[model samples]
Target: MIQKETTGMILRKLRGDRTQEEIAAILGITKSSWAMYERDERVPRDEVKIRIANFFGKTVQELFYTPIEHYKCS
Candidate 1:
């Protein structure tokens, strides 16, 4: 399994203010799939990860490795 940093960012992005279903729709995935991502039970494919990075206006490397303290959505 990957480290929790990625999952943590995702949670920060989705918690309270956003619904899993809404995020899933934005990512072109099913709610259940989004749930898997949230639970850190699965990692998105490379293409999906790229899409997610694009959605957040981040580079894939930044999304995966940048510290949350340094995160910039755009």
Candidate 2:
């Protein structure tokens, strides 16, 4: 089975060794705002979503909607 990966998890993986402040500045947003997005406490506006996806060289769908495989236990 599979489940959708949380945006926070995906963002963390994409962020790698970069700091939140760095990425946020590159995206022209506040560090705390980016932190909320990565924490899944808030969703970016559509325009911000586009910027984030572009920065990562990913489509918004790919970045925010990729599914993760998981095993179900009986």
Candidate 3:
């Protein structure tokens, strides 16, 4: 079974060697805010979620965790 990665893990992996500061700057948020995101201590707003998803060629639904039952959205 494929275990879904946490938002933090997905964010960090997507970041690769890039610094959180640079990514945060690109997203127009503070460095610490970005760190909080990766630590799962905070949830970014939709705008930030969309920006990150676009940057990684993914949808916002794919970026954040979703309950299995929620997948029925058309």
Candidate 4:
């Protein structure tokens, strides 16, 4: 699993004003899956990762490599 800090940043971006359940619905994933992602307990599949990156208007590389701050600037 990746670091919680990374997952936390991803979670914060996905959350917006929605609950985790809401975000999970938007992503077509189970609430438990979303929780696991947030907790850094599991790594999402490539397709799920792509969906998340697309939701945030980010490239996969940005999501996987760049820090949140760097992503914000691009």
Q: Provide the TM-score for each candidate, comma-separated.
A: 0.65, 0.80, 0.82, 0.70
Query: How far is each candidate from the true structure, as Cα RMSD in Å?
Result: 8.4, 4.4, 4.6, 7.5
Between candidates 1 and 2, the TM-score winner: 2
Candidate 3: stretches off by over 4 Å: 1-3, 67-74
- Estimate, for each residue in 16-73, the C-alpha lDDT of model 1 and write its tens digit: 5888888789889898876877777777788988887787787878765555446579
For residues 1-74, write the lDDT of model 3, one tens digit per residue.
77877898889999999999999998899999999999989999989999999998998988896657455667
Number of the top-ranking candidate, with lDDT as the measure: 2
Q: Global lDDT of each model? A: 0.72, 0.91, 0.90, 0.78
The total number of steric clashes, by the backbone 3 Å criterion, in model 3 comes to 0
Candidate 1: pairs in clash: none
**Residue lDDT tens for model 4, 1-74:** 46444765776676788888887898999999988887778878999989988888888776665554444555
Candidate 2: residue 14 lDDT (0-100): 95
In candidate 4, residue 17 scores what lDDT? 86
Per candidate, the number of residue pairs that clash is 0, 0, 0, 0
Candidate 2 Cα lDDT to native: 0.91
